[model samples]
Target: METIGLIAGNGRFPVLFARAARARGLRVVAVAHRGETEPDLEREADSVTWVRVGQVGRVIRALKAGGVSRAVMAGGVNKVRSMFSLRPDWRAMRLLGRAAGRGDDALLRAVSAELESEGIEIVPSTVFLQDIVVERGHLAGPPLSEREAADVRLGCRVLAALGPLDIGQCVVVERGVVLAIEAVEGTDRTIERGGSLGTGRAVVIKAAKTGQDMRFDVPAVGPRTIETMVRSGAGVLAVQAGATIMLEGERLIEMAARQGITVVGCDEHGNVGQS
Candidate 1:
């Protein structure tokens, strides 16, 4: 079987990736972050090594020792918690010292470069699970109302403007008003904050960065996102089609339908695509 390395982080993405890889007859050797990665990952990947955030040296060694020549990064590391608990080894420190910026893309690209230098090629996270990458369409729930569509368009423009700066992938807009832009606090918190200030008509837009590196840091939404939206009073979700992952998509759509939340896939210009 072909062996692939998994650089696992928080959430269900890592486990889902591992499961997909193994199902395709690939051997998955995973390097999971302690406290960040889901415990369930251990049952999906063939083998797993736990490491702290910023332990690039350990990650390299683990993958190398496992005969991993190709790898993919899955899920995300909590930026806020990582700030307080980072344990950078020499390799990570070196990368950090030479980094031009502290943005997510810069840090992730540095890690990818380091791994590539060690002959471990980093592949796109979706290589094994392309089916869940949502295409442009009205995925679930009611069609977007005129006001909601306007909010989505506004959110998309705002997100595109912010993307080049390597900022967050999510923004919340309501009735043409920009409510919240995701920062280190992450998408769920951003949603909660924005939704709280809205009139139950918030539109959540998640998109990839301008010139986003597909090998890592792909935008994702899942069941938790829907649940959060339900609590936050966000009624619509517009994700960049062909550039986002929808984890447990069927379940997510079902939940959205039940909650009367609209889910649509769109382009950078917020033009909803045909299914």
Candidate 2:
């Protein structure tokens, strides 16, 4: 069986990816972050290694030794926490020192380039999970109200503006009023914070960077996102169609329907799917 490398971060994405790969007869060699990755990863992977947050050289060595020529990054590492928690190894330190800025794209590009230098290609995170990638449509609950659709349009504008700044991919809006924008705190927290501020019937929008690099840090949404939105009293969840990974999408849609949450996958122009 061909062995693929999994550089896992926090969340079920890694676990799901490993399971999917194994189901298709691939052996997975996973290098999980010490505290960020779930412990259940070992059970899904053929082989697993643990590494600290900033152990770049160690990761390279481990993947190389396992004969992993290609790899994908799954899940997320909390950016704000990682800033304070990182213990950079010599290689990571050198890369960071020469990096243009500390933005997510810059740092990931540097890491990907370094990995390529060592003959390890970084593949798109969605490589094995295309079936779950969201398509353009109203996926659950009721179709968004006209007001909600407008809110999604405004949120897309907000995200488009934020993208160039590398600020975030999500925005919360209600009746064209922006509630909260996601920063390092992440999507779920952003939804909660924004939902708390709105009068009612808030909409959450998540989209890809205008020039998103799929090799790392791709958009990931699953059951937890739906649950958070339900608790936050957010009524609509819209993601960038074809660019977002809607993990466990059926369950997400079912849960959202039960909670009266509207879920959609749309393009940047906010064309709601045909009924």
Candidate 3:
């Protein structure tokens, strides 16, 4: 009965959100990026509007046309692409002027503020998928060794160190040796970069920023993540409990198990468990 706005980006996350939201009897009004979003989302969304990247005002206008006043940002845009490929409109240019310096979070916050100024509220993307959060504990495969755990702690510290800069949310490490820190290239590439440097035992840790704004850009991992980890020889995937999204929850964990990779959820304090 309610109408929700969805600002969709690339990959399966937006499609999943559309299906889940519609099932709850909410009208899904989606503004999707033309090249980044999956074309199949038209089947899942009640209404879909396509825009190129950086057309913030256009997105808001489309949502308003659909009678939506609340929205969620699902999936992701390639930040590198956004940096180099955007064609900002007048409003987006203004937004970029105000939000240009602080990295991803600042731009998202500015976008949210702009939407609010136009009477649209940005909701948490998990509004309909709360149960899929990576809970604290060992989710699949063997338990992590003390050495792996140390790497996890180190990863957490590194994320905390980097988060305030609005950098990426994941890192690949082994025995405290850092392999890759996720920048605009994204999580999978970061894992691949780190994994290739090691001898089949790198650990990938993904977490929220130290001062993360949960309304947008929550870290997510999916089947492709496991596939990448498998290819890169990363043996463990650790995510921050209750913050990271385990996309396609069961299948992702199952894939990790089949590949003999550990997928555990850890707390901010580094305690590990499954529940």
List, in order, the clash count of every candidate structure.
Answer: 0, 0, 5
Clashing pairs in 2: none
Against the true structure, candidate 3 has what lDDT?
Answer: 0.89
- Provide TM-scores for the models: 0.98, 0.97, 0.97
List the global CA lDDT of all models.
Answer: 0.92, 0.89, 0.89
In candidate 2, position 64 carries an lDDT of 96
lDDT of 1 by residue, 1-275 (tens): 89999999899999999999999999999999998999999899999999999999999999999999999999899998998889799999999998889988889999999999999999999998889887998899999998888899999899889889988799999988999999889999999999888987689999998988988858999999999998988889999999999999989999999999999999988999562
Task: Encode model 2's per-residue lDDT on 3-116: one tens digit a residue.
Answer: 899999999999999999998899999999987899999999988999999999999999999999999998889787889999999999999987797888888889888999
Rank ordering of all candidates by TM-score, starting from the highest: 1, 2, 3
C-alpha RMSD for every candidate? 1.1, 1.3, 1.4
After superposition, the stretches of candidate 1 with alpha carbons farther than 4 Å from their true spots are none
Model 3 per-residue lDDT tens digits across residues 1-275: 89999999999999999999999999999999988999989999999999999898899889999999899999889877777888988888898888866577788899999999999999999989999888888899888999999999998889888877888688999978999999888888899999999879899999988777778857888999999999998999999998989889899988988889999899865668433
Clashing pairs in 1: none
